[model samples]
Target: MDLTINDRVLVVFAEKAELPVAELDLDQTFEEIGLDSLHLMEVALWVQKEYGAVIPEGDLHHEQTVREALAYLDARTR
Candidate 1:
């Protein structure tokens, strides 16, 4: 399995939030980026599709940051 975490996830997120990639703070919460639960659900679904990991929607609440989401998906996909 190619375990590389796709950068496209972040790119799509940035685009959805109407922000530049450089402005994204990996440590910041999704709400801080002008995103809400709906956006997080989209991201969770995206990760499931791209990484072949079945991430539960409830798990999104635990992943408060981009770094956390990436890390969670990386572990599950691996």
Candidate 2:
């Protein structure tokens, strides 16, 4: 089965956060998930490598929730 963009993004975040995918919520902010700036940078790198999309650090930092970030990336990838 093909993973949707949402699933893919969640998996990346979960992996980087060292938490189970089941533990992550789409409404949760990176801060709420215990992810720091370093983790966000790592996620940005993964987005660049995986989707060929260079998300600006400022934009990434501005994202309020996992869902919002995923939507931003999905827009760029498409």
Candidate 3:
């Protein structure tokens, strides 16, 4: 999906991440940014509040990287 200006997924991801927003190259994969599982959970919680959806605990547990977590959120949002 094309990221909307106020896309909460991107918002929370960017806010919690250590990198500057301008540096989050869209061409790069989320894994390349190096956010750990704990931070992923922080993003997930933000997703839940922002999008108002439930992310399954099982899937969240197995999501080992940022890319995987993005895919999980994408599926949930759609």
Instruction: Please tell me which model should have the higher lDDT, number 2 or number 3.
Output: 2
**lDDT tens readout by residue for model 1, 1-78:** 542574777787798789998998899877778888887788778877876788887786634787886677668877
Q: What order do candidates take by TM-score, descending?
A: 2, 1, 3
TM-score of 2: 0.87
Candidate 3, residues 1-78, lDDT tens digits: the string is: 777423555556566666766666544544566655676667666667867777755455432454455666777876
Best by TM-score: 2
Q: Put down candidate 2 lDDT per residue, 33-56, tens digits, no spaces.
A: 878888888888888898898888
Give the distance in Å from residue 14's predicted Cα in candidate 3 to where it truly belongs.
2.4
Candidate 2 Cα deviation (angstroms), residue 2: 2.4
Deviating ranges (above 4 Å) for candidate 3: 1-6, 27-31, 58-72
lDDT of model 3 at position 59: 56
Q: Which ten residues in a row have the lowest lDDT in candidate 2?
A: 55-64
Please, what is the whole-model Cα lDDT of each candidate in the order they appear?
A: 0.76, 0.84, 0.59
